[model samples]
Target: MKNASPAQMLLGLRIHAAAFVATIIVLFAVNVMVGPPYWVGWVLLGWCIGLISHWWSVRYHTSHRTDPN
Candidate 1:
């Protein structure tokens, strides 16, 4: 993992977060269009929280990193 450049890591994070948000939007839209249960909202909420933490870690935790040369 540490072998990856910072750009590579950030790119991965951007893609992963975009995909997750898109998937959550689709699931919520499907739930609304079809009907009840409303489970997608809960799932979205949970995943959103997790994504926030992941983003935070990627952005700040790696900001002060040093190259392990």
Candidate 2:
């Protein structure tokens, strides 16, 4: 795939973060209903790592981007 522009990368990161938050909310509700082990924390931890990585990638790309001019 062609490389994404910095704006596209940032947009993707935002979308990913929003999805993560939404999913975590649903998972937390399910965990509360289940009333036990509370696996939402684990899911949150794993997804957080991915989200941080996505953020770092966007930061790196945007900082390193070179102008075509």
Candidate 3:
């Protein structure tokens, strides 16, 4: 994965973020339909934490990457 181009890595991260958003939306709808649950929020929180970490790592590496010169 380290050999992946910056564009490729960014696209992968974006796809992951999109998946997280979709999952959260579905979970929220399910919660509303079921009249509340203790797990949806936790699931969203956990996924969000992971998503944030991924986003940060991508951003950090993208910014820090040195030009081949």
Ranking by lDDT: 2, 3, 1
Name the candidate, 1 or 3, with the larger lDDT value: 3
In model 1, the number of clashes is 0
- Model 3: per-residue Cα lDDT over 4-59, one tens digit each: 77898899899999999898999888888888445798998899899999888888
After aligning candidate 1 to the native by TM-score, how far in Å is the CA of 68 from where it should be? 5.1
What lDDT is reached at residue 15 by model 1? 86
Worst 10 residues of 1 by lDDT: 1-10
- Lowest-sum lDDT 10-residue window in model 3: 30-39
Local distance difference test, candidate 3 = 0.85
Compose the digit string of candidate 2's lDDT tens values, residues 1-69: 028988788889999999999999999999999999988999999999999998988898789877888
Best by TM-score: 2
Candidate lDDT scores, in order, read 0.82, 0.90, 0.85
| Root-mean-square deviation of Cα positions for candidate 3 versus the true structure, in angstroms | 1.4
Reference-based TM-score of each model: 0.77, 0.93, 0.85
- Candidate 2: the clashing residue pairs are none
Q: List per-candidate RMSD values in Å.
A: 1.9, 1.3, 1.4
